[model samples]
Target: MLNRKIQPASYDINEINFITPTIHQFKNNIPLYIFEGGDEEIIKIDFLFDAGNYYSDKFLIPVITNAMLREGAGDYNSEQIAEILEFYGASVRLTTNRDIAIAGLTFLSKHYEKILPVFEKIIKEPNFPEKELKIELNNRKQDFLIENKKTRFVAQKKFLELLFGKTHPYGNYAELSDFDEITNEQLKNFFKNNYNSKSCKIFIAGKFNSEVLKFIEKLFGDSLWGLNTEKNIIKFPIQSDINKIHTEKWDGSVQSSVRIGTLCFNRLHPDYYKFQFINVLLGGYFGSRLMKNIRENKGYTYGIYSSLVSFLNGGYFMIGSEIGSQYCNDAIDEIKKEIANLYMLDTNNDEIKMVKNYMIGQIMRSFDGMLNTSETYQTIIPYSLNEKYFY
Candidate 1:
């Protein structure tokens, strides 16, 4: 019988195990990582490239190139490709991040052979049609214009500018005018340069077979898929100028959004886990100091959170919240006091133990399936890291 009143006793995290994918090299220099089997007939395949927003020569080139991949590629137009995938109950997605662009596919293992050629064609022969490019440009530009009016959007944009500075790749933003300047020729050039096997790493999971593996090797490994394009040099020099607060004033804003943080060491550091635990105790969880004092006790704001976000080259620790405009100053003061308290006193051993346990549970839930396990591999491989990253 389970007791609702009594709580389970806490213990130190003893061990955490992660599934590491078996890596194979394709003849064309692309590396593929695999997690063998699961109960589901479905599988996920991912193609990762460093052609993210960071690598874009201009603000929109990388994104525009990635977006136009499925718009038209090798015999199948956008609607035809969509119809085929929809008929097979499969899906395709391309996501652009600060560091990379991922082209992902999910389909039943039975359809792997049928769609592998289509996938190959999509990867190697994307034609950025003028009609599709025009439609996408207008849609994205109009969407941004609408979202730009929100306080959250304005705050997040300003936050990146402050964190990375105006000159850094991560900081430079695409403006409305930049959208108008995107050209099909530029997209073609960028794709030829960056979206090649030389810049790609692959990950696949679910019920795997040797035939499918051979198919992958033949399509990607045995061929010169990228035509051996040379990668361009993109510089991202870090700035020591931090510890500054950037405020974007909005006259109509009834609520003030605040982002306070500083760039810190990435996950490769030994102290990262410790710092992550400290962040949780500070505000990473509901019972954290900031939430308890600011929201639960003082009636100041609705919510608050602390995060230690690790990137490919750098990381940052941030405490974020939005509050009534009138109490903005008070909220800032309280946030500082909470942080100061951490350095001012030693944390209790029991409290530290609890946070560690919470993190362990979180990791278990995150890596629960083969798909998630493949994602876990994706995150680590970008940094030249392996399973030991967790321990």
Candidate 2:
């Protein structure tokens, strides 16, 4: 029987040692890379492709291709695929950002052999069935229509357009007409152009035997497909020189949503850490200056926040809030005052320490799950960052 007794006061804390991950890498002539780690039960598979909206026609192709990936594929219809995954107690999901699309799977390691075929099918032979496309388009259109009614949504859209010109891919709004124009043929073409093995990296983080590694290599190796020779170039747009603000009034709105921001730099910037600390002090937490001054003290609004949004090419700092419609202008003015105050005053060491501890705590909390940890590393790896940044 295992001992359940509590430790004595004399117990030495230094005697305890936690097992850290054993990192392993598989190198092949193939362009793809896989990172794996785990001990027994769960296996996670992440397939990353550089086929984000920024690289394609910004309107629809990126989104449509990602959504339709699991609709149907070789030897499996959508229902069949779902049923098989559920039976094996597995989950498959897709995530996208401005620069990449990630298809991830988490399954019991014991049943990996049963689920691997389904994964192969989804990756190798996505059919992009016509019916699924129609259903998805309708759903997206309805969502957009509903979001347009919210003042916050309206403000956010207008803010992006103002920051980056309306014609730019990062700033454009999606129209129902745009969805109407996308056909199944165009979706298939986009997939064909972007889904080649050369542009992808497969990351497997979990317990696996030699067989699984061999399977991954075979699935993504020379036997399956060849490298893409075309150049993938992305250019960052020029930033707006002047500070701009725009608002669109929504009739009968009970709350006014506000967003304030300007273009900044990427995670690789030398001042990234300092800027992170600054953001936390400004609005990155419930106890932040913005929240304390605007919500807790004055009671001008229900909630407020500020954050640094980092992208592959550049980043931005934004302050967002929702206030009673009558208090919209007041909330905006107060938010600006707080920002100005930070620049005007000399920050004390005690306050800086408090904010630093808060930010560190928040980051630790975000990594409490396997999925989130894997994603954190994924985001960092592309930017050439390591765990030392957090420490």
Candidate 3:
């Protein structure tokens, strides 16, 4: 039974400890990190690579190559692979961002042996068949067309291009012609160059034991797979303009979306933690200054927020919102005022304390379960960091 009327206690957290996993490296340079917890006989393995937008020599090639991996592989066609995964109650995901791409899979421990072969096919034997490649390209082209028509999408895409220059990998976007230009041969070449076993690490989380470990080692350990992929370096510099405002007109539009941001630092910078703390006070939360001023006080829009986004090469601070087209100027004015206020006025100790508490709670929410905990650790591995940083 729980108390209904009594006041809850107020407490402070002194330290946080994460149950970091045990690491086991395979014969091939693939490292498997195992987080052993949870009641159900399920395990999720995440394969992470430094292959993302920034790694591609051509626009959209890295992501397109990653997405096509599951379309056809080995002897199984797209539909057949889907049916097999579904029959085993397994799930597969392939996603990419500016910094990296991840291929994830989850299944019951009982079906581990049965499901392993299918994943092996996806990893080592992706065919990048022509029919499937064409279908994927056409569908993506349609999505791009639809997305470009949306005001928010236009604002976001234009913002990135402006921030990183039209030619930068992180800043550039694909044209419809670019999608049409992709060939199955290019996809095969890109996949071969990027998705090698040597470039990835495996994160396994859930109720797993010695037998499960043995099974993974037997299947993946002895095999000689993956291309020797070195970390990419851009010989040229990526540049961004300052104090830029871009306005794109969409006829018959009822609202205008706005993005205000500039190039900043990556997570590896020493300023990362303090900048994040300052960001929470500025606009990182619902109770942040931007939301309080722009949305609640002035009713400029239903929502407005800011973020200090971290990436592998660099990061940025963006303040975004969708408001009535007429009031877009007013909202921008108010946002500037809020920033000026932060600079002109003395720092508020109380605000910092409150934000600290709120961020602690947010961190707690992120690690609330076993799978989430494993995923949390998975994020840190790419940075060459470990659980010790958090502890």
Candidate 4:
């Protein structure tokens, strides 16, 4: 019997053991990282490619190419792909960002033999059918139009454009005309150039067997496919917008979205961890100073947050919120006051202890389970950092 009134003992977490992935190489030299642990007979496999927007000459080429990969590959159409995954109780997710593109699949470990071949075809022999390309582009254009209407979306987009200049790949945004202008030929060409064995890494997590590993190697590692050439590295200069302030007014709007930030250092910077700690104390959590000042004290907005966004090329520190139009000026003034207070006031040891405990708890949660630890590893893979980064 347990006493409901008595509290559990709390001890300082001095160390955490992380489940590191076992590294292997496919026949064609593709890297495979497997995190094997857990009781459930489920597994997640992620296919990472160096095919990202940085490699595209046009605005929508990389994203469109990524979408079309699973649309129609080999003899499987989009419907067939969906049907197969559904029949096996599996799921697939495709995503593209500025630095990398990923195709992730999750299913029962028993189903790996049936599903791996389907995904293999999707990655190796994508046939960018014109009809599927048009459908995807049209749907994306609709989403673009809808998102542009929201103040927060507009502010975020403009903020990136200001930080990285329009000419740089990170800053460039897609226009409506870009959707119409992008053709199947362009997507096909981009896919052929970037989605190759040479530019690929495979990550598998959860419970799987030795037979499963050999089967994966048989499917993906058997041969060099696509262009089979080394990735071409390209560099672009960062030309930041010189202006200190930028504003775009929207007619008949009841709210004003504010974004205050400047470019900062990447995760590899010596001060990265320290800067992240300070950010959480300021606005990264519910008990942060910004929330305490603006939301609880002034009743200005529901929530406000500050975050340090790190990218392959660069990073930035941003504070953002959408406040009532009438309170915008007062809210901005309050935000600046909070920033100044960080420097003017002395933080008590109690507050410091609280923050340290909060951050440590969050880190522990990230490594609580094998699947979670693997997902956390995904965040660091782009930076080429090892598990030691957590420590």
Candidate 5:
């Protein structure tokens, strides 16, 4: 085996400067902002809205609206949209999380001028064609049904239900009945209420000029801005007083999946970094304590890991593992023992230094590409943070 201790010639990472994007406040009096960058090869545009599921009449409204946005708009059908975008070598993506929805576009800088009009039509006039909605709903329901049969899925869903009550927006699972309950009229109403200029923020990165800015102004600024019909703020319930444990058996499974966690704080909390460091020492890395104890030393499982997940409305620290079904109880007991030990004693200086280095290396890896960098910002912007937090 190769030596893992061969240090590279240059350990200096000073050249990696995390620069915050230049912000340009639009004069249009709309809730629009832009982050301008100078790369001339690729251009990215992100339209963010608070149309997340929390504000909808039902849990799946945001899901349907986001999925249907790119299916058809204006004179183009789903296939035509795909063909046009492919012809220009451009990509259009739509994503929805617990509290926000984003529609984004990326294309070669040379073709940006040609592709901007297509994006404008898609964003401004999406037609929720009935046939497309039925197909998507059926596809999603089937996927969910399949996933529910797995041990990991059972453990994860149960863990969330335990952390937050089953009725809570963050904890609720979508049912096939819920999909059938959704109608095209409800989706259109949800879109009209949330996808207005006043509720959106635009982010542009890479190769923008005065003319491009003018085009953006004409397309987005001149449009009438309307406020959302309703504003609902999601408040995560307090962490449960009890340390909850749940288990479900799936017959004929070779391995059992386990998840353990509790509701935690958002990124704005001062303890976010501390908890992140603690998590690394516990199970965040391959060489973490949990892996060493469960996989390396005991040979009970192939892998084990944990993470701190922060959403717009709330966050949590989760540990997950898959092991031979016979070792399920033993693995869970060891995990709890490790967690209790972390709270009882302090880690040593050597371990602390190693975790810090590992975290820094991971942060650098996350910024290695343009798309990843853009996504990093998208994840952080909702917390009212800039890149400086990571640097």
Candidate 6:
């Protein structure tokens, strides 16, 4: 113990094993994954549904529908629901992304029974009251207006529209008119079709016992609910923009946001992880080539990043930064130069080793706690992959 000069032995990250949760099915065939481990009595439950934008035929319907679920439900109004959750020291989160929507609740295990019934009302019996819907839409419209003024927001939005055509579910964005045009009937219809018990998956993490399991089964799995409509398998072909380059000018802006990217493969592709490893060498981390060249060496901006983003239908490789308007051209040229360097020059062993160590640490961080491990598994569930993907 006193020999401080000698270093401790190190093991490869590949030697680490991820704990797989015990998978069970509720009576209605809803998948329940339980990861039970924690010193505290807190528990987290996530209900994932196929009710994302991909399933919506209209803009803003999926997200607005998901958000409005909590505004008013069965016997309780929004304020009553809020008061109940606060009294029980519970937190609720409802969000929709491109491919899925999630309703998450976190609270102490002692309050589980009391809070779950309220959640059930929110999930199954939302009324989509007109007054609440009007308020939510107006607030969201204001946020959209504010975000639309920023160069970064404009660049990001256009980037997606260009990467996948403006009509594709993953690429489409909302206009202000959408707020005025959307109807409650559409929200109800989308919710009825996509949030059915059959297509939902449940994930629970932290200290939970058999009683909690039984209660969940009794409430959510005892019988089929919602419209119980079979899910539609819809596919949209990628229709990327033909133009290689385009620009938009902001009247009174001193900074320019730059986004350069191309379409890539989804996580299901065999080479996804390998390409992600290479992407890290380029810009996936702080010590990456893009950071060293663009930020530290040239002082182009405070930071720059490259990512290999995975999605349900497809993925993309993007490099983004906000820089002084004057340096925009120079920065873009430098980025291309860096890519050329990667292609023309061989990476030295030292850089490769550093990146490898960084990624290993990242993988370890992703599974640092039981809840975090559960969250990591969530990313893979949509792809029908298992915990062994970590290996």
How far off is residue 37 in model 5, in Å?
5.2
| Candidates' C-alpha lDDT | 0.83, 0.74, 0.82, 0.85, 0.80, 0.87
Ten contiguous residues with the weakest lDDT in model 2: 11-20
* Candidate 5 residue 169 C-alpha distance from true site, Å: 1.1
RMSD of 4: 1.7
* Cα-based lDDT at residue 37, candidate 3: 89
Report the Cα lDDT for candidate 5. Answer: 0.80
Candidate scoring better on lDDT of 3 and 6: 6
Instruction: Order the candidate numbers by lDDT, best to worst.
Output: 6, 4, 1, 3, 5, 2
Quote the lDDT for 33 in model 1.
96
Q: Write model 5 residue lDDT over 234-310, tens digit each, in one string.
A: 56454452656655557888888888887889898888988998999999999899999999998989999999998
Score candidate 4 by lDDT: 0.85
Worst 10 residues of 5 by lDDT: 27-36
Give residue 299's error in model 6 in angstroms.
1.5
Clashes of each: 0, 0, 0, 0, 0, 0
lDDT by residue (tens digit), candidate 6, 1-391: 5798999888655577778889998888899999999899999999999888888756699999999988989999999999999999999989888888999899999998899999999989998988899999999999999999888888888988999888998888999799898778988888888888977999999998999999988999899988776676889877898753334447577778888888999889889988888899999999999999989998878889988988888888888888777788888899988988887658898998888889889888988877887888889998999977766
**What TM-score do all the candidates reach, one by one?**
0.93, 0.88, 0.94, 0.95, 0.90, 0.95
Clashing pairs in 1: none
* lDDT leader: 6
Better of 1 and 4 by lDDT: 4
* Candidate 3 local lDDT, 1-391, one digit each (tens): 7797988898888777767779998988689888888898889988887788887767778888889878889999999999999999999989988878888899998998899889989977899988988888999999999998888888888888888887888787888789878998887887887788778788889887798888887877766576775756774367787755555546677788988878899767877777887788888899888888888989878888788987877878888888878888888888888878877755678887889988888777767677888788766678888766553
lDDT of candidate 6 vs native?
A: 0.87
Candidate 5 residue pairs in clash (backbone atoms < 3 Å): none
Q: In candidate 3, how many Å is residue 85 off? A: 0.6
Give the Å error, residue 326, model 4: 1.6
| Model 2: lDDT to the true structure | 0.74
